[model samples]
Target: MRKFLALLMLLMISMNSTAGLVNAEADDPVLTSEAAVLMDTQSGAILFGKNAEVKMYPASLTKIATAIYAIETASLDEIVDVSEEIEKIDGTRVYLNPGEQVSLRKLIQGMLINSGNDASLAIAIHLDGSMDTYSKNINEFLKTNIGVEDTHFVNPHGLFDENHYTTAKDLGLILNYAMNNPDFREIFGTKQLEWDGESWDTTILSHHRMLKGEIPYEGVTGGKTGFVDQSKQTLATTADNGKLKLTAILLKSEYKRKIYEDTIKLFDYGFAAFKSSQIRKGETFTSGNLKFKASEDLLVTEPVEKGKRIVDKDGILRIQNGKGEIIQAIELKPLIGKKPEAKTETAPEPKQSGLLSVNTILGVVVLVGAAGVWMVNRKQKKSRRFRSR
Candidate 1:
């Protein structure tokens, strides 16, 4: 009878304050796409997903990586000599002649804005001297720097290959990381660019209907579109609703409109249901009659819930809500009364080296390349941070 009474008291405490955890039981959105994911760009928390981690062909959406990679590694103003090979490439083209000299930046604009397969070929050849080197260098860039694991690109233009694929969740991570690059964001969000090409003389427009304002969305900041017979349709988009920023991806949609409709629905749900909350490192809390301190800045976007902290005997802290659901968990050291250590200046900690800066992803460190892109080695964990203005 005494034990039952003790359990009841704990239940009462859980109902009253779930250790100050963000709690929201928002309605989950239904999506029609075969695979989709919606995530908080800032908090790195996934708001929703369907087959998020499942591999699927990304089609031309691969250009999102290609465009950003070139922007970071290549000298944009330098001229690249177009090869006759670019002309023979199938699919979209800006129709470069056999021996045309075009700026690297111009080719990027052509590839991204026009979805020019030929232009992508030119870029691959110019940057690394051949398709093989481009493939190796780009894969290295994505793996080492951006921290995307589930994605592997076989082609710069995302032309369908059996091995070219990525998950919607992975795409969200890549987009979020890329958005930190000002140059990449500017190009990704651009609706159109003026094209003065050897064969085509007109303003090249974005294929994304929403980004072009043909299908208006209120907070649409950036987007990429892709299609191939095998991958069907793929899209990556970013939206900000003043309070929260979101990165959403849809891949392998059977219908063209399905991807767009799913994306808009996700934005609507995310904006309406989620809000960002943060808890600083070393902030103390008591739950289950135990004391704990936050390990890092705990950031999340969720429906407001009365939070409570609960700790087990092993010093593991679980931030939960009034309903006893686990929102997030962090390891806490035993709270002991001791004199605070003397302050001393120390070198800043190196940025996290992971495939994704998933704020709560399996205890990974906070990723720190928000203002730019960084290159790191697979065997090396330190960020070689660089910002491109």
Candidate 2:
């Protein structure tokens, strides 16, 4: 009875602990914004969201798609001349005069850093022969490959067009894809850009102030900022707090300070609540199934990184195992043929020899017997002749 009571008491304690963790996360204050979302970049898991699917003007954030498309379709060293049509488009400009030539690399920088509408137009014109074609290509790419359904683009630059809009979730997805591309990530994370005697710096002091120690948040790697009367002060940032890396998106906030505050709150909540645990490494996960010839399994001859986490409800509190290690490897053994049949103890018979068969031995015996009979017949004839003499 005492043992049963002790087990029951332990169960109760565990349940209570779990409930407290859940409630602590559920009670976290939601930031005020038209739209917001927090996500884990590696796992692609959404941690928190409010109106995440509502479409709104993206402002300069459209440049992320434009840059991705341009980089893929054109070489960086290729020269592009500014067209008169590109010069006439409205919104931000890198002040590229008509017929001013620049490398595709520089144009990408201009489009991203300066939010240069002109550069966006030039890239579109060069890659697709017209802005309309470029818009169609970007739409196709987003729908077929990037899986961003809530976004639509009528212009390369994120100017306030009735057709230009994306949700916070979709924007996050886009940025996630863009960040995977080295060139796009480097350009977007850059706070300052200079080329061809021209320079553009982020209008917002730090691209990621919460991560910059301006607002007391850690793990701010880099991100992008967006603003327009319609979009307000919008920011998307990625931060790592040792164990967890979080992507936070905020839209239509009152001011830059409010955006940073909201971001910091979300990041702090994530860092305190959850931790990154790598469940499987690419090689480790794939090596288990590798088959040599027709065999089903093979030994894992190579080392692989394995990791995972025991995260709290909010994904903070990285539980350490004394060594600060969260990953380990699993070795796999190879499987040969099927198992032998059960209960048949007798060993298999030895294979037959090809050199001497039963027929060959019998034939040799018959020939020797016939030769002995012939010799005996000769001896009898000789004895009869001697008796006749």
Clashing pairs in 1: 18-307, 18-308, 19-307, 19-308, 19-309, 20-307, 20-308, 21-307, 23-305, 147-355
Candidate 2 residues lying further than 4 Å off, grouped into runs, are: 1-26, 197-216, 281-389
lDDT, candidate 1, at 378:
31
lDDT of candidate 1 over 288-371, digit per residue (tens): 677777677877555554555567877776655445656445577666668988888896988876654554563433244422
Prediction 2 TM-score vs. true: 0.64
Residue-level lDDT for 361 in candidate 1: 68
lDDT of each: 0.81, 0.70
Error of 2 at 73 (Å): 2.5
**Cα lDDT of model 2 by residue, 7-65, tens digit:** 99999999999988765532354686778887765555556677889998877778878
List candidate 1 stretches off by more than 4 Å. 1-25, 285-299, 305-389
TM of each candidate vs. truth: 0.73, 0.64
